[model samples]
Structures are given as C-alpha cells and as structure tokens.
Target: MTICKGVLNSNVLFYKKLKMEVDMRDQILEILTEQRPDVDFNSETSLVTNGILESFDIVSIVAELDDTFDIEISPKELVAENFDSLDAIEAMVERLSEEE
Candidate 1:
C-alpha cells in the first residue's frame, strides 16, 4: 500500500511539472508573438539559423524571459542552443530556476 501511494504521488508530481512546463511555453510564445506578430513561431524551429531572430531580438527575448520568470540569465547562458526554439528557451529557464 505504501509503495502504491508513493507511485501515485510521483505521478501527480510529474503531471504537475508537465503542466507547468506547458504553461511556461505558452507564456513564452505569447511574448514572442507580441514581439513579431507576422512570424509563425510554431513552425519556425530555425529562429537563429534562418535569421528569423537577430541579435537585438534575442536580447529582447532574454529581457522578457528574465522579467517574466523572475530569474536572472547569466551571460554564459546566452547561447544559440539555449534560445534556438521555444523548447530550448523553456529548458534554459527551467534550468536557471532550478539553480536558484
């Protein structure tokens, strides 16, 4: 019975974390859309590679994410991989939040 309870609790935590991640992604997409409404963020995975987002856009995104998430992104964390796609940005935010 104790083992079953533990498993159930773990599942609950997992789902909660998943939901949080989805919410974070949505919030990020909102910010991105507001920045560039014409661009299709959902389909554009090559934001940096394809020149969809330039250096200034990246700086703006970093500021928005920093303010929204209440976490400070270090200078070293400002890499292409961290801001390549919505998932990558979310992962970076989550990692920074964990560190804090």
Candidate 2:
C-alpha cells in the first residue's frame, strides 16, 4: 500500500531516521574502537572523567569525527559531556549535521 505523508508515512520516516542514527552510532563505535581497542566503549562512560581519553586522543577523535561526518566540531563544543560517551558523541554529530 502507498502511504503519503500521513501517519504511516510518518512512522516510516521515523524508522528510516532511526536506522540512519544507528548506522552513525556504529560508525562512531568503529572509530572509537580503532583508537582504543582495549577500551570497552559499549559500557564505559567515564572515558573523559576517568582520564581514559587524553588530549591527544581527543584530537584524534575530533579529526576522525570531522573526516567521517564532514562536520566541523568547534573548540567550544569540545566539552567533557560531549565526549563522555558514544551516545553523547553521536548526538553531537547528529546535531551538528542538522545544523549543516
């Protein structure tokens, strides 16, 4: 059945957006794992708080994020909360992408 921009279409769009977000999350996971294979990104949320992520690591992450998503992460956006977890990073990327 063909669904216009009605309820069913809205649900379809929602699911498509959800799948895109999940794909973005997985890409971010891959990048983080490449940076620190020993770290458990799935469960570890104190990467910045626990000093698991150093300045150099942040630089590398920023570069990778910029390259992967084609979005610029400004200096002001580089806060502990933004890089605290994979979810946070993914949200930031989605927000920035929306801005662009």
Candidate 3:
C-alpha cells in the first residue's frame, strides 16, 4: 500500500530510506570527532576553504560518505561555497539522500 507524507513506515525498504539521514549525521559526527579530536565536537564544523580540513581529510570524508551512504557526491557540490560547515554538509547529505 502507498503511504502519504509524514506517514510512519514499518516496511524494511522504508526503514532504510528513512534512516539514511540519521545514519549520515551520526557518521559525519563520528568522522569529524575522530579526525579533529581537539576541536569542540559540539561546535560548528567548517570544512571548506576555512582550512579546518585539508585535501586529504576532504578526500577521506567524501570516500566515507560515498561508501557508507552509497550516495555519489559530485565535484560541483564539493565546492567550498557548498560544503563549508557541518550544517551545509548535513543539508547536502539530506538532499542527496532524498534524491536517492
């Protein structure tokens, strides 16, 4: 049967789809915390050209996100203007996950 907006899903497929955002958020937090243990985990995470993260970190994060969520992050979306802060990253993840 088809479900409407905001309808709770008990099906397996629906569960996986619905949980993607929560999983992405947790994974992102885990990665950021592990990479920058000295930084304030609760505070904002600015990863773009602000320099908090280097090329390597970005590569690793992108890899992890791709593998974990099975979502392909395009180069155009990788710009500093788009994936700068944690909020921005979360937004991107949500958007990509939704598209999937």
Candidate 4:
C-alpha cells in the first residue's frame, strides 16, 4: 500500500509539471503570435536565422516575455539561438523561471 501510494504521488507530481510546461508553452505562443501576426511561429523553427524576426521584434518579445513571465532576461541571454524557435523560447522561459 505504501509503495503504491508513493507511485501515485509521483505520477501526480509528474502530471502537474507536464501541465505547467504545456501552459507555459501556450502562453509563449500567444505572446509570439500577438507580436507577429503574419509569421507562423509554430511552423518556423529558424526565426532568427531565417530573418523571420527582426531586431525590433526581438526587443518587443523580450519586453513582453519579461512582463508576462516576471523573469529578467539579461543581455547575456539575448542570443539568436534562444529566440530561434518556439521551443527555444519556451525552454529559455522555463530556465529563467526556475532560476527565480
């Protein structure tokens, strides 16, 4: 009984974490879509390399992400790779949130 309960608890925790990640991704996607309505963020993986997102767009995204996520994106993290894809942006936000 004790072992089963422990397993159940772990499963619950895992589900919660997974749900949080999904929610965070959705929020990031919403922000990105709002910033650039013409671009399809889901399909494009090379947002920076392909010149899909310009410098001003990055600036706006950084500001919105900072305000929305309550995470301070320092100058060091302002790299092309971090903003290259939806997954990259989501990963960066998760890392920053964990640091805080």
Among the numbered candidates, top TM-score falls to: 4
Better of 3 and 4 by TM-score: 4
CA lDDT of each prediction against the hidden true structure: 0.87, 0.91, 0.72, 0.94
Worst 10 residues of 4 by lDDT: 72-81
- lDDT per residue for candidate 3 within 1-100, as digits (tens), equals 3575336555666889669667777887787667667655456556667687777777777777777777899887777755577767778877887898
lDDT, candidate 1, at 37: 85
Local error of candidate 1 at residue 71 (angstroms): 1.2
Instruction: Please tell me which predicted candidate would have the highest lDDT against the true structure.
Output: 4
Measured by TM-score, how close is model 1 to the native structure? 0.87
Runs in model 4 with CA error above 4 Å? none
Task: Estimate the lDDT of model 4.
Answer: 0.94
- TM-scores, in order shown? 0.87, 0.90, 0.67, 0.96
Q: Model 2 over residues 22-41: C-alpha lDDT tens digits?
A: 89999999999999898999
Task: Mark the regions of model 1 whose C-alpha exceeds 4 Å error after superposition.
Answer: none
Give all candidate RMSDs, comma-separated: 1.4, 1.9, 4.5, 0.8
| RMSD score of candidate 2 (Å) | 1.9
Model 4, residue 68: what's the lDDT? 91
Report the Cα lDDT for residue 42, model 1.
83
